[model samples]
Target: MFVWHGRLYVVRQVLNSWSERVPWWRSTVQPDPPVGAVPERGDHRVWRVEASPGRALGTATYDLACVPPPPLAGHLRPTWTLIRVAD
Candidate 1:
């Protein structure tokens, strides 16, 4: 789930999702990996999704990347960052 312009949106479909080799702490953004992609020592996972703004209105595509929790923070659930949006 995510909020945009005061509207909460929910993912309706996963258009694509993959894991990559880059560390989540790095500021660099790599190009998306192929579908069903796998990486050695992968550290980042991104998901491209179609979401609706909570009311069955038009949908938008959202690219979200998982921000892994700190080491030993197993009690903490991972969070996601909103990377892109398109109608």
Candidate 2:
């Protein structure tokens, strides 16, 4: 489920998903690893999902992303972010 612009939407189907690696070389802040901990490799995952607002509202495709936890925090859950809404 996701909310946008004061309206709530439910994910109907996931069309696709893919992982993206963060370009560490391009970043100013280098990732620091905790003692005995392996660094996290991926940055974010993009998901193409079909969502429906409601019976009154039609369905639409949306691009969403899941941001992975920090390198030192392997047990933490990933956070979801909206990327774009397709017409």
Candidate 3:
């Protein structure tokens, strides 16, 4: 979920979610993805939104497992912010 302008929106679920292999040559990680920590390709979610004025619509991935309370609230509801995730 995220906020735009002054309105709020929620991502009920990812629709056309997909992922690409992390380019090992381009990657800076000391260790590459162990086996298959992430998916190679597939469409993710097509967020369901309640439209906002100045808000810029886009997609972001999140790992709810690490973030704590307050920050997590944004995901559970709508806000004018983006949830950053590393894949």
lDDT values for all models: 0.74, 0.81, 0.36
Q: Rank the candidates by TM-score, best first.
A: 2, 1, 3
Q: Which ten residues in a row have the lowest lDDT in candidate 3?
A: 39-48
Instruction: Summarize candidate 3's per-residue lDDT along 1-78 as a digit string, tens digits.
Output: 455445554554453332234355545545555762442222222222232233476544432211122433444432
Best by lDDT: 2
Runs off by more than 4 Å, candidate 2: 22-42
Q: Could you say which candidate leads in TM-score?
A: 2
* lDDT of candidate 2 over 1-87, digit per residue (tens): 988888889998999999877676745477576775445455789999999989677889998988877766768777777888996
- TM-score per prediction, in order, is 0.65, 0.68, 0.22
Q: What residue pairs are clashing in model 1?
A: none
How many backbone overlaps does candidate 1 show?
0
Better of 1 and 3 by lDDT: 1
User: Mind giving the per-residue lDDT tens digits that candidate 1 earns over 1-87?
Assistant: 788778799888989998766556453465555764332224668899999987659888998988676676667667667877787
Selected candidate, larger TM-score, 2 vs 3: 2
